[model samples]
Target: MSVFVASLAFGVISASVLAIASIGFTLQFAVTNVLNLAYAAVMTASAYVAYEVNQAGVVVWVSALVGAAVGATMSYLLNRVVYTPFQRRKASPITLVIVSLGMTLIIEFGTQAFVGGTNVSYTMANGPTLGVGSFVFTGAELGIVAVAVATMVAVHVLIRYTRLGKAMRAAAANRDLARVCGIRTARVVTVTWILSGAVCGLAGVVFGMNAGSFGATSTDIFVVLILAAVFLGGPGEPYGAMVGALVIGLGTEVSAAFIQPDYKDVIAFVILLVMLVARPTGLLGART
Candidate 1:
């Protein structure tokens, strides 16, 4: 019973981080139709930024904000400079995917060159642990959960109620139709990039904090899990992403009870594979 409870608590924490990252990823696919292989690189870059900021004696929350800013800036520039030009030239989706893959390689090597092969950790003091029923989490872990919930809620509100959100939905549905309706599709795309980028950056920092130590490859490996959740939840659907994250997070953590801890990540991949074979559109995604 205690083991089950602990696993559940850890599952929630994993789900929280995965939700943030997957939401950002799916949002980009929703608005821009780009798979963005460079997303992992952006996450790593943002995590590094947070590390540097924390080293400067800044608060973790503030460092996270800076990391988010860096992500937003990097995403915006990538869209404006690389993806946009290719899009303007009417590049095929495959070509864009290939381009993004190349970009990922560059960013990964660049990061490696800059940060070297050293594993770095956040300089954080341990916080008080709080237990609810059988589940226990530290103040920091609870804070992470809170932040994830707030971010997800904010995204939901933006997409469901606001005029800009309606525009984004229309654009996602059909860019030509949205532009025909004078919805300013370009502006909507830019906003999408910024929002997704911020979420990605924030996710990266929180992930590092939770893990205790991370290196450049951390986000690269994490990106696979994020992609799995994004696809499983249904690409372009924020709510679906959250649901998928919950399942993946819980499934992986709980699997540790029966299987070797080293196989935890494999569980996510298996779930993803099953989802792909059974329902390509995802659990909540409507078939196009």
Candidate 2:
């Protein structure tokens, strides 16, 4: 029972990270209709940026901010330089997916070459351990959960109350119609990428912190879990992505406590497969 509880605690941490990453992934798709296989690559690059900053003796939190900024910049450039050109040419969705996959390879390998293809860890302390009954967490882990909660709240307010959020939603629903209705859809898409990229960057840093180490290829597998959460909740549905992240995070962690740890990712894959077969539209996704 104690072990179960401990696993649940770990699951919450995992879910927090997944929620951040999955929401960013879903938002990019919702606004731009881009699957962005390179999203995880962006995460990896941002983390490495943070790692460099930390090595320079900057605080980890401050380094994370720098990473987020880099992520936003990189995302904006990718959209402007790569995606926008293809979009102007009316590229097919599959073609864009292939392009993103190619970009993923380029970014991952490029970073690997630069970082020497070895595992690296942040130079930050986990701080004091805190326990509540059967649940235990370090200061850093708690901080991660707090950050996730704050991010979710901020996202809710952005989507529910802000003018930019409304415009984003409008553009996502029907870009042509929104443009006809006088919304600057291109601007909205650009802003969406920037916002989502920031979140993606933070998630990458948090993921590395939780794992204790990371490399260019580390997030490649983690991307699968993010996809599972996004699809389980519903593609392009932010709220649904959060729910899916929680489910997958908890499911994988608890299963790991009982089964082999090596199969944790397998558990996520099985859940994703089941969800796909059972309800392709996802939990909150409207049927097309």
Off by over 4 Å in 1: none
Residue pairs in collision within model 2: none
Off by over 4 Å in 2: none
Q: Candidate 2, residues 1-288: lDDT per residue as tens digits?
A: 478898999899999999988988999899999999999999999999999999999988888888889888889998999999999999999999999999999999999999987899998888888988867689999988887888788888999999999999999999999999999999999999999989888888888877889999999888889999999999999999999999999999999999999998899879888987888999889976
Name the candidate that leads on lDDT: 2
Candidate 1 CA-lDDT value:
0.90
The TM-score that candidate 1 achieves is: 0.97
**TM-score on alpha carbons, each prediction:** 0.97, 0.97
Tell me the lDDT of model 2 at 212. Answer: 88
Indicate the residue-level lDDT of 253 in model 1. 95
In order, how many clashes per candidate? 0, 0
